[model samples]
Target: MPPRWPRTPDRNDPAFRRLEDFINFALHAAIYLAVNSGLWFFQLLNHPWDNLSIVSGVWLLGLVSHGCYVFILADYRRIEAAAQGNWQQELATELEEDATVTPDEAPSSPEQP
Candidate 1:
């Protein structure tokens, strides 16, 4: 079966969250707009002749476009990749070194538990 939710960036990672807040914001905004879509149709009950649906319809279209960028084209890759640039491989190597380092020899950090 397919996943119910879209493939999203890790929220716990500050690099992915704040650096690419637009992706997360767009995703949630789309959901809110989608849920409210029916309200636009219901507006027909009061103003059958006015039909101002183009407002919501155009916003929904923009949401679909943003969704395509986030889920299909994978915009998160560009954000994270730009942060590491050429140091990705070097960072990986450093991570491997940290794995083998004993607690006593490990580097100190205020956040390390």
Candidate 2:
């Protein structure tokens, strides 16, 4: 029988949760890289490394502050739902497809009269 509830995300689906983690990581990395580059430019201009090092600290803090953990959790939750074979989720997917199904390709129902 089809599942009665929506499918939960499968945290095991490496593609799902992992992707979110990757995104979070990339975001943090980008922020860090930008800061580092700016600091490097300043150092080149004779600014002291002492002040520039602060950017690294801020970058580290931003990784946690940006809620990377939350995104990872959310991704895992989605994977769990999918693993549960949730019919509600299946139905929703089918409905979405139906909206796109061409009229000519759609099956007809009986007792139209």
Candidate 3:
């Protein structure tokens, strides 16, 4: 079946794209929690504590895996880190070059009339 909402045409808008990702992730996590809540409620009255523990443990694993992807595997994070590293290097080079440039090569500031 086709998607309920048509595919977005303005894929270049970074803000919209990121908000879409956030919404998608929130929906999935909400569904997971809703299901787990139901499961735990049903099992609480009759099942052993050990059985309930298993259900919670498995759900915790799912959350941790999702968090790892969002925090580490996301491409934007790597790109941001790379950009920051390059900026730091450029600042260092400029500072070093300024300190080493001889008075003859340095451009003089314009004097006020």
Candidate 3 C-alpha lDDT tens digits along 1-113: 74354456453444444556666777768987898788788777776556667777787788778767665665553344344566566667768988996667667789989
Model 1, 17-79: lDDT tens per residue?
544656576666967666556665577567453435666677668777866765566544444
Higher-ranked by TM-score: 2 or 3: 3
Give the higher-lDDT candidate: 1 or 2. 2
Q: Could you tell me the TM-score of candidate 3?
A: 0.45
Pairs with backbone N, CA or C atoms under 3 Å apart (clashes), candidate 1: none
Please provide TM-scores, in order, for all candidate models, with all chains considered together.
0.40, 0.39, 0.45
lDDT of 2 by residue, 1-93 (tens): 953423455546645566556667787778778878887888989867775667677767877666656554444544555667674786687
Candidate 2: stretches off by over 4 Å: 1-14, 48-50, 61-113
**Residue 70, candidate 2: C-alpha displacement in angstroms:** 9.8
Best by TM-score: 3
